[model samples]
Target: MTSMSFADAARICLTAKYATFSGRARRAEYWWFSVVYMIAAVVVAGICLAAGSVLPGILLLLFIVPMLSVSVRRLHDTGRSGWRMLIALIPVAGPILYLVGMTVDSVPATNEYGPSPKAVGQPVG
Candidate 1:
């Protein structure tokens, strides 16, 4: 299977799957969108600092759902339940474990979430 592109990943996460907490997401899709989210957050913070406005808060509110959805789907891709994300509610160790789970490679085949997102012969672009 061809790996997904950064642009495609970002597009899917920010638009198509914005609030979709079901299904599976490939590593590239999750990580690339995370990078974009971080960069946008930083930029928004800088702008808010300079302008003394509420842009940062607004941006955070806007992206929170999509971020959570993507994270849940990422977990699903690793064959875990979306509810597993509740582990992040704990202190330090919990967040670390949660992150480690997110880093796991996708299941090669299907689990309860449906077909593998990176399955062979799929058009990934």
Candidate 2:
């Protein structure tokens, strides 16, 4: 696989890995994708508000799975189970903990999820 830049990783997450819940995502990949996701949400909401129609909501729905899947994979990269994503349900602490999880660096070596994405020649799984 070709080496991926931050932009490429974000694009891949939105396209190729749209609903890929299994596998690992590098911190860079997850963060970059998140930035794009937020931007898209803002844009879509603006369009929906301006148009005064529910149609644009469909676009947001389309992204739901990809967002969740990438979040799960990001947790997996930290050697955590996808189910752990449920922590986001708690009032304040949950979101804070989840943010910490996403911000931390990946394990230097492979855990149960797979090889380290930082490994040379290891494609982002």
Candidate 3:
């Protein structure tokens, strides 16, 4: 999982169905994708800030959702509901809660979200 590619990470995110909050995350699979997403966002935001034109600026500003899609997927991979993202709106408590939740490892076996992602990584039984 390179820090720049979105392909594999996107697949992992899509396959993660439930949000029960359990299991281990493959560090590279999740973190690197996050780094790539953040860096791209910063660059895009900078471009929008530098551009003076309103329409073009707004156009450049529209990448937020697609960019964060992977993060949402990562959350799903960790068995977290995508709606949990709304926590960002709660001021300090919001982000703190999100951080706490996102930091928790995945449930050990099956969770509300679906089967264990770890099972997919191991040799077949």
TM-scores for all predictions: 0.92, 0.89, 0.57
Q: How accurate is candidate 3 locally (lDDT)?
A: 0.54
Residue-level lDDT tens digits of model 1 in 23-73: 998888889888888988998888899889885558777778878899999
Q: Residues 10-99, candidate 2, lDDT per residue (tens digit)?
A: 677878999998878888788877887888899999999999987987888877887888899889989999998988899999999889
Clashes of each: 0, 0, 7
- Deviating ranges (above 4 Å) for candidate 2: 1-6
| Best candidate (score: lDDT) | 1
Q: Relative to the true structure, how large is the alpha-carbon lDDT of every model? A: 0.86, 0.83, 0.54
Task: Show model 1 residue runs off by greater than 4 Å.
Answer: none
The predicted structure with the larger TM-score, 1 or 3, is 1
Candidate with the greatest TM-score versus the true structure: 1
> In model 1, where is the ten-residue run with the lowest total lDDT?
54-63
Candidate 3 Cα misplacement greater than 4 A, ranges: 1-7, 10-28, 54-63, 66-72, 77-79, 120-125
